[model samples]
Target: MGIVELKNLTKSYKQNRGIMDVSFSIEEAEIFGFIGPNGAGKSTTIRTLLNFIYPTSGSATIFGKDIIQHSKEIRQNVGYLPSEVHYYDDMKVVDLLKYSARFHGNLNSTRMKDLAARLDLDINRKIEDLSFGNRKKVGIVQALLHEPKLIILDEPTSGLDPLIQNHFFELLAEERDKGATIFFSSHILSEVQKMCDRVAIIKEGKLVAVETIEHLTKNKVKNITITFEQPEQFTFTVDGILKREVNGKEVTLLYSGEIKALLQHLIDLPVQDVLIEEPTLEEIFMHYYE
Candidate 1:
C-alpha cells in the first residue's frame, strides 16, 4: 500500500472551483512532485491532506488511517513547510526550533547543530532581524528537525539561494534514504525535474497527468529544425506531425512518434544541419490544455 492516498477527492467553494475528482498516491521513500500553475488548487489539496480544512467530498488517507479522523496522529508523523511561513517576530531561531521540537519530543543537540551549520542558519538571530531567505532557512530546519516519516514541502525553495537550495535537497535525499516519503509541490519545473521520481500535474482545478519524469519527457512531442542545402518546398506527410513550417531553406517540424521514419525521411533529403529539441514540462502541459 502507498504511504499517502487521495481517492476521488473533490473540494469546492461557493462560485469558485477547487480540485475536481483528484486522486493520486505516493509511495514510501519516494520523492513525488506535485506541479501546477498558480491558484490551480495545489494549496487547497495540500490543506485538505494536512486536515487544515475538510474536503467537501471524497477521502484522504495516510498509512491506512483516514486523515480527518486521525489528524493529530498523522500530523505527528508529518512535517510541512508552507510556501509562506509566518512566525513570531521576537523569537530567536533557537527558541523557535526548541518550541517546535517539543511537539515531537526533544531533538538531539548534535543533529540540530549539524543541520544549522549545513544550512548556514544562525541560531541566535531574532526572527525579525533575519532576511527573507534566512527566515525560510529557519522554517526548513523546523520541518526536518522532527524527523517525520512524511515531509510535505510547498515551494520550499522559493526564497533560498542556489547553494542553500542544493544543500536543502541533499537533506531531503538523506531523509528519503532513511525511509521518509516526500511530497514536494512547486511551479518550478527544473527543481521538480531534478529531484522527483514522478510528477503529478494539475491545471485549472483538474488533474491532468501523472507519470514518471522519464515517461513524461519521452512521450512529449519533439521539435526538429532542419536546414537543407537548398530551398525546397515540401510538406510533412507523417501521421503524428502536428506542425510544419518552411522558412527559406529551414524546415521546422513538430511531431510525436517513433523517430525511425522521420530519420529515414531526413536521410533522403539534402539536409545541411539538423537540431532536435525536447518539449519543456510547460510545453507538454500547454498541448494538453489547448
Candidate 2:
C-alpha cells in the first residue's frame, strides 16, 4: 500500500465548494508536489488528510490507518507546516522548540542547534521580535526537529528570501535522502519544478493531472518557433496548438503534440532559424482550463 491514500475524497462547507472525487496516492520516501491555484482545493485536501476537518464523503488513510479513526497515531509520524504560521508572542524560539519537541518525544539539542545554524535562525529571540522570514525559519525547525516520516508543507517558502529558499530545498533533499516522504503544496510552479520528483496539478477543485516532472513537461506540452529566410505567412492545423505569433521572418508556435511530426512539416519550409519553447506550468494549466 502507498504511504498516503485519498480514495474518492469529497468535502464541502455551507455553500462554499471543496474538493470533489479527488483520489491520489503518495509512495513512501518520495517528494510529491501538490500544485494548484488559490481556491482550487489544495488547502482543502491537505486539511482533510490531516483530519482538521472530516470529509463530507469518501475517505483518507495514512500508514494503513484511517485518518480520523487513527488521528493520534497519524500525527506522531507527520510534520506539518502551514501557509501562515502563528506563535505566542511571549514565547522565545528556544522555548517554542522545546514545547514542540515534547509532542514528538525528544530531539537532540546539539542537532537542533546545528539545524538552527544551517537555517541562520537565532534561538534567543522572542517570537514577536522575529521578522516574518525568521518566524518561517522557526516553523521549519519545529516541523523537522523530530524528523517525522512524512512532512506536509503548505506554501512553506512564502516569506523566505531566495537564499533561504535554496537552503530549504537542501533541507528537503536531505530529509528525502533519509527515507522521509514529503508532500509539499504550493501554487508556485517554479518551486515545485525544482524540488519535486512528481507533481499533481489541481484546478477548480478537481484533479487535473498527476505525473512526473519530466512527463508533465515533455509529454503534456510542446513549443515551436521558426524563422524564415524571408517573410512568409503560414498557418498550422494542429488541434492543440494554443497560440501562434508571426514577426518578420520569425514565427513562434505554441503547440502540444508529437514534435517529430511537427518538425518534419517545418523542415520543408524555407526556414532560417528555429526555436522550441517549453510551456510553463501556468501556461499548461491555462490551456487546460480554457
* Model 1: residues with Cα > 4 Å off, grouped in runs: 231-234, 242-248, 264-270
lDDT of 2 by residue, 4-36 (tens): 999999998777879998999999999999998
Point to the candidate with the largest TM-score. Answer: 2
lDDT for model 2 comes to: 0.88
The local distance difference test score of each candidate is: 0.88, 0.88
Backbone clashes, each candidate: 0, 0
Error of 2 at 192 (Å): 0.8
lDDT of each residue in 72-99, candidate 1, tens digit only: 9999999899889899999999999999
> Model 1 lDDT vs. the true structure?
0.88
Q: Pairing residues by index, what is the TM-score of model 2?
A: 0.94
- Report model 1's TM-score to 2 decimal places: 0.92
Clashing pairs in 1: none
